[model samples]
Target chain A: MKTKGSILTHKPSRRQVLAYGGATMLSTPFISRAWAAPVEINMLAWYGHGEPDIVSEFEAANNVKFKPKYYAGGDNMLGLIAQSPPGTYDVILSDGEFVQQLNAAGYIEELNAADYPFDDMLYGDFQKFPGHWKDGKLYSMMVRFGHLGVSYNKNAISAEEAMSYSCFWKPEVKGKVGHFDWHLPSLGMMSLYDGNGAGLWDLSGSQWKKVQATTLSLRPQVGGYFDYGGTFNSLKNGEMQAMCGIGDWITGVLEKDGAPVGSVVPKEGGIQWTESYCIGKGSEKAEIVKKFIQYMLSPAGQVKSAKMAAYPGFAITKSGRAKLIEVDRKEAKRTGQIDGMANDPITLVKEGRIHYRNIPVQQSLEDWNDFWSEYKNA
Target chain B: MPVSGKRTQSALVETTPKRLLSHLLTFKNAVRLPIIIWQALFFIAPLMFMVAMSFFIVRNYRMTEAFEMKNWLKMMGRDYFWDSYGLTIGLATLATLVVMTVAFPAAYTLAFKVSENTRRWAVFLLIIPFFTSYLVRIFSWYVILAESGVINAMLGYIGLGPYIMLNTKFGTIVGYMTLTLPLVIILQTLSLANIDRSLVEAAHNLGCRPWRTVFRIVLPLARTGLIIAAVFCFILSFGDFVSPYYLGGSKPPTLPILIVDTVKSGQQWPRAAVVAVVMMVTLFIVAFGGIAAAYRRRVR
Candidate 1:
């Protein structure tokens, strides 16, 4: 027992045993650190939000991974959330108009208003965006926004022609017009064209029918209905001379690629599509998700969103805009994000040329949808 | 007869039915049981569920369990539904006819004109396209068919056409042919290749014209396979959403697009279910009717 070989082969003295136990204790943490699994957060959102360009920095910093499920439209987003079980999604990105519906269905968690930088928003209305709060409690946080108007092939439709909704019915572009294959924005544009103005979504019964008639009148000139990708390709290739229901959010990407395309808000006005984020109701990872939301609102996150490869929208925060201007000034100027620019997004909002996109006010969503299907068939 | 002999005869009669029942459960049936179970579990059960779902109702965009005719009635009453249905049927029928006609000559060449080794190589080449996604193939057609594309550029040399083909029915037809032409040719080739050469020789020796021999001898022998191929074309074309939407531009929405629109609008899944059920019924009728017509004996 006193010899070294005998001590290793047989039971050791108390001093040797204590030394071995202390060594094992010191190495345990290093071994565990080498093999610990990163926490996974399930995200449901529109495309591009969860991509490496946006989330890699945050993931590396926080020791977590993201699994994203992407959807195309607000209704599609709602359908996916409805079909899934509670807690399946740890984080959800939603169109502002559907946040109320999400809250009503008990799908999203109530967020603390103080945790976000509402005071740092580019516009005051974003502080209390419609449908983001109920009973004075915040349910979601506004992240980014875009305007929807007439998107056109610059070669086919001149800037002047694209400035008014009436150009969609131009005789030269007949059977060359296309829709973005969503009912809300397209029908909302039709309402504005019908001269509803501020009351675009709040149409009465006769007004709703009149809006339907207006959309039908444009059907003959309509070449086809296309989803997001189809709309992009059709416009990029000149198959569609003018597209309704989309704006610079789409054309901006093509312009960056040197495609002769642009989006302009018609004199009638444009619809504003706001995107926001919320924590799922039953998510056990709420603490991490809350931190993620705060991170997305940071200036670095805002820069990533502005330069998103999928589609682009305006950064919502003041610091975010400053950061975008600092890092990518050409892009900032291209999208008119600079202060005092004629097409500046904030200036457009101040001029009352943009209306928040919303659900139907006077009729059920189904009614509008039915008319849309009818218009498509026509 | 003795009492013991009478008793044995009665016992044999009583056990005859049991022996016949045991004999019915052969190895062939044992092999078939798994497939039958699979169909019941995967196909029949889902079909029954879909039928049930069509009767349910949606409130606030949530589908709830209830048996009602409202979804069916609402969909059937809409004029657009009928319009889409008519358009879908017409397009699918047209695609079937065009594919069958175009594939016939190529199939005939492959079956009779080409060497067996060459025919096998051609079949392998036809199968190669299937390895790529159909959507990708449709997208590739864009570069070749666009107004400023390859075809149009070549036509410009002759001052021929800047044809509007990409967003029209013509484009849809092209996409359909791209999808079904090769498959139809392979099927028709296999069918025609299997026919007895003696029958064709006899017809030719009896002074039958070449075309006449084909119509009388070749067509009848290959009728089953040809009809099945046509049925497959019709079914695929009827159900395809990509060709009509991407190539045809969904200028006038088809039934499949209508189904999508129905579901997208306020999550009216019940209404979409209504559309799906109607499509299923139509397909079942077409498939069964086609099979019956294909196998029917010709009148003397």
Candidate 2:
């Protein structure tokens, strides 16, 4: 088995596993799934991406099983990939910007243009996104895109105030803004607030020191660094007023839980994160993997992905975006998270405020991390 | 096969290869074979690789086989790393002392003052918390101590100000004490219960006061158990990631937290491994060295 992340974060130790009681929960349901299918395709993807309906549909259609093991971040996914034998995983769902990194590291195979519904679905910018290609060979497929923006409980903080980077430092919002623990985008957002949003990937410059001071000054205001699963409760309980790293999904999921929270991209701009599907380099079931990717990006599959348990977000494909609009009205009432956020990814692409990170990492990742360590230690 | 006296003598003196093999092929050895093999393959083997990994060069996000001290040098050269070390030791020490102070009295009362019929029930009550999840118990401190939590809500009802107890060093200390108190009490109680009651009576007969008897007689007798309990608390609290990660905020980063960040965000596995190795070695020295010192003191 492949593993990654903080030793206990992704793949927990025996003691923690017992503490979480996740193994019993995760293992009990899969016994039947293991026996029913003769062919199994192992997938490493985000937690909510594998909606049961979508997996079961894919399973019945192909007379095969889709074994979805969840991961938290792109870095952890890469670690899992690096540790595994090439033939181990059939498919990977990861950040779109990681295609070049994966291809460079020889972790994934290039895709055929005919295999995907590029012309029928994807917008022009994402159709042949440079990150998804290497030397003109297609290496990955963009599935969804979201923003790294502030999300707040409107009762505690105004949406307008939340839409500015200053919301974190404002005296009014102090002691209530929870910083999401994922350090990379949190740093990027801070740099954007400092008007040096560009070159966030390389923050060894003078801008970094300024951002460092700003982050340290705001330390007394930060409630805690929250994980993905904890964000909803922290916001709903009013334990925090706003979070620096929430996206559409976090806000949407919170709304579903009847929390009065909304997400906003500040006027200073926000970081954009895009996810994609790719075939592993030595996948024994390349053909099956390709079929799975096709199904995932198809209109119905995209609908499932949009409404996946984690939260709602924009699909890269035109058909998928249309499906998101056509979902249940109760589902659409997610604090307006689905109202305008994913309406037009292309327009946001034109705005030039959105930033894509090079994954598994950028060239200046180590420096960026050192900068983050200063914020944390401070 | 049955053999003559000379052949038996020769086999006993210098066994043939077949005899040596047959001697080892017993049910007792066979029964223990899997456990030994498993220990060697899983535990000892991974530990050896971790130590070896601490020496390699990590270039271009992947470790290479070349010998390098860069990971060690980088880890050691930072004051930030040592800050985590200091916090880890401080948190563990304070936690141990708090738990020991509370547990010693509780264990003493249960052993001497409490009736025999009630002792088992008291011990069971002390252990009732363990039946719940350790994570749940640790997280309860967050639910009970946060600015908006139950404790502050009660204070607010009485016109007292809501205290900011969560995300502080004090909150972490409270969490560690709660987590470790049950174990300490159980260990100390077991030791206290095992002491012969006749010693206490003899000290009383010699005109010693009850408190003095406890201090002069019971404590010295229970010294070994107290040492064991303190060490257990220190090790558990020192290595814990959940308590500090949740409650310590970002103040002085804990050692385990730093190790996890380096591995997860920095992708510096070799460096992470080195930090882990250092922590393991330090704990090893503390645990074993403490045991040796305690044994020597007891002998004297």
Candidate 3:
């Protein structure tokens, strides 16, 4: 019993055990914290929605990390969700137009309406955003939106001239008009220009042809078609006198940087691009994600959206708009966030000068895309 | 006992070559297996998947497995696809010609006119551009090529007008040159520097002009490398999306851009695959043709 191996197997006395237990208990919090892994929440969103600028504060407060998978188009967003496992994403920040598709595919969870602040919404449309709810149940929550209209170089095109979509064809700006290369918004603008009004996307066959004809006619004026970066650079540098299919979402950044660029909801009306948050269908972190969406809809979150560094959108809630005005009155004023301002986006919507950017009602998206490709080739 | 021993010896004698052959094959396979596995896993498998995906259909933005030519028929039926095809071929061919022509003199200087140290330094400097992102390099050109940018400002100083350059076919070519020129120069220099000095000396001793010596002696010997370099440039330019979209403004839309548009529109990856397959076929034909022409010897 007293052999060399017996020394290795010796048990601790009661006093020794108590002392050891006390030391271990004293260090437990530090040891556990040192080893504790932060929870990971996967977010599928547009480029800036999940970036540190928007999510870092929330991350630090919640002991969670966001892993963002960003996409450029609604179709792209849908494609990504389809390819992934059911619970791969904990949250999805989708373009409002694609929320319907996401819901139709059953990729998102049915959210409780009571969790979000629908009563605080600045616009009535935000209370029941089209396609965000099904059969009296909420699915996605609208957070921010921007209008797509004629974005222009203020130095070249007078504000009055830029008011109408016909200014895109001005003889002076010939070979200087640029398109923001997505087919939907650009063709939608063309539809509005052709006086399709609220039925911009729900075109009759003849109206669709007319929209195509109008876009083709502008081909000679188009210097180039550009993505976001190109559109920004061209306008900032005065290479493009006018741009179609974009608005303050782009030019607002440039204007802040002393670029003589501005975007206006033209006389032909404009299209609204909204972005919203939804919990993924099978996310185990649905409660936390729901909290995050509520946070995004909060005054602080709305302020963040309004002042998002990547590209700004209007604050959707009344309290959020008030917070933006209080904190950054200059920005709020510049973007026409004040209630009675001439370019107030809410007023534009109220006046029926803004239509939600939607997929085509009569024609398939591919048909519009096909015609777009044809237009570019023309 | 002697007859039985002879039969056993005869059987062993017959089996010896076959055993050696098996051992030899095992050794050879050991040497070749890694590369075979690599090509099969990375290249053949993906290519097969791509071919299969092209036949599959997309429903609700999700790809479902099927064997059909619907995507092919749809893509091929579109006029824009053909237009994009012509534009892509034309632009790539133009870029290849321009790169080859522009790179030759610089390569010649580096090969023959410069000291060895200078040539080494030049090659090193040429390679430095690759350390930075190609998209960054393309963006930098905006500061130099924009309407109010450096070149235009300089043009304005001499009373010439500002010209539109940044988003034109000309701009696309410039971007392509930025991408391919350095590699082309290094290639041409290597090919030219490896020429037999004695042959060039002999041509010169016969009172051949310097330019004539280059044409008569230098070019033929470097033909293989030079042709290969041009082929590389063509391939790079043909598949490029950034240059055409960012610099060329995607006015007529190249095949690569068209592929992107096709995918972005309705998540029609099958249709995009159709475009991709066409591109791959064209590239394969061009590469094979180029190689055949490159190594072909002139019969005396």
Candidate 4:
């Protein structure tokens, strides 16, 4: 009796079957569309103290959210872009050379100049890429800029020795010199010693050979190759007598540790790298991203970022520079380091004590790579 | 009897497809699908992409659609790549051999000679180093090995001049030993734990000395574990980027450091990728060979 009753109710209602089918069709498309959100942006940058705040502020102000991805350095940033899908990021920060690379690869979109109104505010040199940009259309905007130079341990090396590029390769500095593990800067310095005169981008075949030979010659005098963190720690502990490092970090180290550290731009000058922010080509929200870039370049934004210890890309508005000076003085007074901001590029270059010029992107990268390889294996 | 046979046949016929479906639905088989998919997605796909990319020339920082062997050719011509490869392999091999040699004796003592409570503490001590970040450990070694660091500072107190060890191959070797030793000991101990204690006792009763008992009975039984541990130590020390980058001085840059510098400085991705693939393949071969050798020894 029970089996027969169950068989009688086994046939399903048409309305119930139709409702189930409709729900499946509706939910499948709805779920797929939910996975594709419109108001999200992916931002890739090297890790920095100010990045988290900037991202959060932008997200809140625009009523949109961003996922920030951080890489260790410029190379890693480029490697990630290479491996990732085209639209994986909406914004990316990289150095000048990589900006050119990205533009050439069509991985970046031409920034809308009309939307970003800070064109006149940038340093003249920052407006154009000597080799990579063409036809007066800019591919990237400068986010931050700084000079690369030597930092010395005040306890171990004399201030006079610290001022000269020759101190890096001195016999007494053997097992004490800490050069950047990077090839371009180290070999570029070597090129200067070989009489290429800091214009590493313009070195001829003979000069290039001389640079290579000089680097190999200096290998014995070299102590260790260091990245940002290691170089700073080694300098602080007096393990490294002298090192090739960024000017900003040197200033920061002195301010933090009150360690007697001095930086020099050297007689032959040094390389200046500009960290540029560009909109990714695959970004669906290019207009909004461009607006964010514009805001970053504004005086208010630039000053805010600069006060946090990052160098501003735009020429500091007179007021902004004054504010920066005030900040520096306050920092100096607190740390007891009297000459913290004296390595400003404008002053250094005006005094004829240091020189810096744009490095050709492709040639410089190739030269740097070649020099590094030889430097390591030699 | 005929009715019984017919009923059995009908039962067999009825359950044939159901039995096949149940076999397919077993827990082991159900889990295998996801594991296979994971392996393909995580390992096989990326490797295939890397190999394909290695054959292409990068133009303007983008791989061209055209296929070429220019990267491979350039790599072959470059002496630096070969030199780095040789140095990396040599250093890794030396470090692996040293680690195994030191770990075996230490593991033996911990396994057989120590009391149970002491053995637990010893194993705990072995793993304590791993609690710190790898970079911090490597940096700590610099403070220990540098000319003006603790060791030299102590030496100076005894009237000896500063001992320069930090940037030398010796410093790197010492650091590698510190890095790999703990792991080797832990793995070997786990392997040694499963050994039958009566065998060692029997060997001792048979008049074999302690050392002979270790080599003849204990080590052979734990051969598989030793090989696995050695493989780990070898791969780790061989492919180590941070240790050499921090501790190794100018003259002998290890392969990973060189690869990193090349890629970063020049945007020489192709050449860097080639070096990376070489290191990866070397590690794979060593890992597989070590396991195979252990398996052969075990079978014998």
How much native contact recovery, as a fraction, does model 3 achieve? 0.92
lDDT for each residue of candidate 3 in B30-80, tens digit (9 for 90 to 100): 999999999999989998899999999999888999999999998889898
Q: Please, what are the lDDT tens digits per residue for candidate 2 over residues B40-99?
A: 999889888988898887654566776788889988987778878888888899999889
CAPRI quality level assigned to candidate 3 from its DockQ score: medium
- Cα error, residue A116 of model 1, in Å, equals 1.0
Off by over 4 Å in 1: A1-34, B1-21
Q: What is the full ranking by TM-score, best candidate first?
A: 1, 3, 2, 4
Query: Against the true structure, whose lDDT is highest?
Result: 3
- Candidate 1: tens digits of C-alpha lDDT, residues A193-228: 999989999999999989999999999999889988
lDDT, residue B166, model 1:
85
Cα lDDT for residue B199, model 1? 93
Fnat per candidate, as a fraction, reads: 0.79, 0.29, 0.92, 0.58
Local distance difference test values of all predictions, in order: 0.91, 0.76, 0.92, 0.70
DockQ of 1: 0.73
- Using lDDT as the measure, name the better of candidate 1 and candidate 4: 1
TM score of chain A per candidate: 0.92, 0.83, 0.92, 0.76
- Candidate 3, residues A226-340, lDDT tens digits: the string is 9878988888888898999899999999989999899999998999999999999999999899989999989999999998988999999999999999999999999999999
Model 4 agreement with the true structure over A46-66: per-residue lDDT tens digits = 655236555566665666677
Tens-place lDDT digits, model 2, residues A1-378? 755468546755789968668776878667666656558888888877665755878877677877788877666677777777887778888887666777888888889978899986545778887678877789898877777777888887787788787878778767677877776778777777878755665655466677777777878788677667456666766777788876777887777777888777777777778788888888889998888889888988887776777766666677776666677544544423243555244555567767765421233666666656656666
**Candidate 1 lDDT:** 0.91
